[model samples]
Target: MASDTTNGTRTIKITGKEAMLKNKSYFKTSTGDEAGCAPKKGVVTSKIKGKVYYTAWSMDVKFEGENVVRHMDLMTHNHASMPGNTPTWPYLDEMAVSKEEGPCKDDIKKEKEACKEFTPHKADGPSPCPPDGKPSTKDEADAYADKTAAKECLRARRCQLSPYAPTGKQPGCCPGQTGHHVVEAGSFYNVGRGGSNSTAIEGTANYNADKAPCICVEGCNQYHGTHGLMHTYQSTAALNSGATTQALPLEGGKQTSVVSLTYKQAKTFGVDAVGKSFPESKCEPACLEAQLDAYHNKQGIDDSTQCRSIATGYKGDEAEKAANAAVVARSSRLAAASASAPSGR
Candidate 1:
């Protein structure tokens, strides 16, 4: 039973309505394979005890209006109404709040006491020479110790005490050389086919886009491995590519009615960083939206030929000239230094 701070003082009992809606996304077939349920039509029905229950909560409502999108409650499927009632998954008929429960006071006290003892070890302390009569309090001493420890942790490339620390420990770096260029596990590259006289290429351990395709991250899948080196962060560029308009080829040289984007068009879409391998289904929505927008505007969506033009600043050809001048100036300085140095060879 998780408590949410937003709703305020309300305990959410998992009801049949809620369960049916939540699990609507997951429907199993007789063979155990799952499929999306088609939309249900007309008034919703729930067969109860060989009879019907006209519960308003069970009704699947659809809004009516032009350009208005239809939204269903989380559990309502396309075809199925209320789920088939079963004792194993009984519906919560009612919900009421009694004395709410929370962590025991003793447990809270114990946690606070333990926190006091688990203070991070400090690496430095103030000099014995203190201000006239000011003595450091326990809280101030602990804070100073924590600050010193934090500085040491950063210097040693250890985890920080902050919430965003990679590992949950005193703010210090990883135990070993974890971040000094290491690729994800199970990710490696081969220079060529496995055979005699085959030697791996030099610098084959580092990731270079010119060399090989990106590899999926290991435990934390944000980075991609290539060759032997790893590149941080996967790009979503592939998902945002342009339109496709080709009929998929079927067996026996037949063509399917469905259209898809051409390879050129797909590449034209925003897919440089993410690479070129993705399912047609993934690119369909954006393609269709672009096509629809183009079709709508083909007839000139607005009669007014609204046009405006503006210019700003000089071209950067001058900036390039200035950069070249600076380079020449630096070359002159290097030549002067070389000439002034005494040579023995």
Candidate 2:
């Protein structure tokens, strides 16, 4: 279970009277179709009995004043509170620790080959966005693309995630590429560096579900696939089920929502992402050069200095200027070397 490591212990508490669980965002119908559970008043009732209990561990808990924003204990949501028991005050319940929030030793052991290849891509690592993950400006949004890039504001530090490797590793890239958060990290589920076991931020749940959205990606989702064509980590199928929301924006003022992926479904989609390939569109000279430069610091990986420039569709920035100049200089050096070499007969 992901824990609050602030002082190094989960600051356990009896959920106060007002703590209310949000509707189960994603669920399976009796026939097993992915679907969403909505709150009638505030509580979500299971339709399929033992099969459709809300993903208690994957939901947010709201209290009168002590609202929790992170994921809850992972389990079969089979337990039911007493009829008169509101699950609030009077009689109370303790918050469950984060379920299998991210990859565990067993998980790692299961996917060792994929684990060995895990590398933190620049785009997938920490960025300048705030802990809430809501960027006030477009620059903070996604400077690489334009307004509304669907990539999750993957700002959690590996240290922050403690044991989890920032949502099943994909080891590579940024700007042109992005980290797609499988379980919607849009709001509180998306920010703050609080320990999974403690509330680092007052009045807010500790930010610890590195394993909650443990699912690798709600990817290959073509909901708004045309927005930026920026996501390359997945492309297995079209998301036709689960809860959908236009959580983030994209280039050209377009937007897209995240489709929920269950643990089993996530496994089916291959959390390792080992077999995925870069988007065919992103393999162009400029995109490739920028990606290579980001991955290996080889701006001159190819003779192209236009990596950043083209990747952002010509969005000018100071880094782009310097990068372009460096590429140009390298190109010149290569030309001079060619001229000095003896020609073949």
Q: Which candidate wins on TM-score?
A: 2
Q: How does residue 12 of candidate 2 score in lDDT?
A: 36
TM-score of each: 0.14, 0.20
lDDT agreement with native, every candidate? 0.22, 0.24
In the predicted model 2, the residue pairs found to clash are: 4-197, 17-88, 17-89, 101-211, 101-212, 102-211, 148-249, 148-250
Worst 10 residues of 1 by lDDT: 306-315
Over 4 Å off, model 1: 1-246, 257-259, 265-271, 274-345
> Which lDDT value does model 2 have at 262?
30
Number of colliding residue pairs in each model:
23, 8
Q: Candidate 1's residue-wise lDDT over 50-124, tens digit each?
A: 221111122222212111111111111112333222101111122212212211222222322333222221113
User: What's the lDDT for residue 53 in model 1?
Assistant: 19
